[model samples]
Target: MTDVTPTPTPTPLLEVAMPALLRHARHTYGAAMRAALAARGYDDIPANGLYVIGALALGEAPLGQIIRELRVSKQAAGQLVDALVLRGYLEREVDPQDRRRLTVTLTERGQAAADTQREAREGIDGALLACMGEEKVLHAREVLAALIGIGREGE
Candidate 1:
């Protein structure tokens, strides 16, 4: 009798296209963040709102950066900001340095919401780190960053 060696089959994840993997992977973080936000009473953020609020929370990001990151038109960005302002999560004030221009700042409610968002994101990061281990996580980050760079090179 001849001994048989079974052929290896690719894992489901290994067979997924990068784009599909990215989309689904994004949903995992989105679900975690949304669940956390809802539990913490921050369910009011609109579609595309999370990126803006979280960016503001992290620090000063330029309008150009926001537009690029959101992949949104300037008009769309303005409308989003307006909606956030109306929701009481953000406030717009006349720029002290330039009276003709306005500055958007986070309201107290926004700050709380941002904190919740950060915690939720950190939770996902921690889970990934634990599951993938340190070296593997770092390599994953490098690969993702390279993918992002590919997009930028086209722009």
Candidate 2:
């Protein structure tokens, strides 16, 4: 009996470098975002909570829709909504068609929070873009578009 060893393929640049770069980018971006939010009296809210607020700011959505859009567990999404509700950032309304179904909407406070966060994010993003240069940023966006196309090929 002979045993055969499979030959290893050379690692692709995107495969090896992209994961780390993406992770670092997420971490760095998240930290900067958090700091910006904190500077505007939003430090009490959790990061996920802010996301919920932002999502609701777009329009009134049911709890289930928010959960699905955010891709979070029901319990986690519920907890986040609950916190936002307690903090006066959100309000729960009974769906007109179904009383049993609840919809979450941002209150005035939530809208303010979302707007403040958006402004902070824009400032941070603008600074990063300025530093990276418009050309490089455009090139990076093109590369990401290519990656997205490749990723969708299997689907």
Candidate 3:
């Protein structure tokens, strides 16, 4: 009897590339930020908590808005906010115009954390630009922006 050779299956492309790319970028940037913050005696904050702090980088925002922006469950957002508040990175106050609403603002420490994240991101971006060139990186940014815009369209 003649032996038959088995056919090899081809590898499939990722179903969605953005999520994988974003996850990798987040992990890399988070590590750099964590290292920088740790060097400055700010090691208590977790990497995930940094996202919440970054969301408030612009200014105070309602808790509900932050939850929406974060795209996280209410419970998850609340836990993150609670942790940040306990770590002195954030503060919550009642909205003057709407006492029923709670607003979140970054503390000085939170601002420092956000600044560290920015620096880390800049470093990562520079490295990416060097590796992939400005044209490709800029194109990628545009694509990412478009994708985000699509996500926000429903809001």
Model number with the top TM-score: 1
Better of 1 and 3 by TM-score: 1
Clashing pairs in 3: none
Model 1 C-alpha lDDT per residue in residues 1-155, reported as the tens digit of each score: 87698877889998999999999999998888899999988888888888888898877895558757998888998889998999988899998999999888889998898898889999999999989899999999999999999999998
lDDT of 3 by residue, 53-149 (tens): 7767966675577678777887877788888899999988898999998778889998998898788778888899899999999898899899889
Query: All models: lDDT?
Result: 0.89, 0.76, 0.80
lDDT of 1: 0.89
Report the C-alpha lDDT of model 2 over 1-155, residue by residue, as the tens digit.
77798877766644667778878866766676677767877677865776677767766674567678677888887787788888888888898999998767788878888888777667766887989988888898899899879977965
RMSD per candidate (Å) reads 3.2, 9.6, 7.8
Poorest lDDT segment (10 consecutive residues) of candidate 3 = 7-16
* Candidate 3 runs further than 4 Å off: 1-18, 60-62, 149-155
Work out the TM-score per prediction: 0.90, 0.71, 0.75
Clashing pairs in 2: none
On a 0 to 1 TM-score scale, where does candidate 2 land against the true structure? 0.71
Which one wins on lDDT? Answer: 1
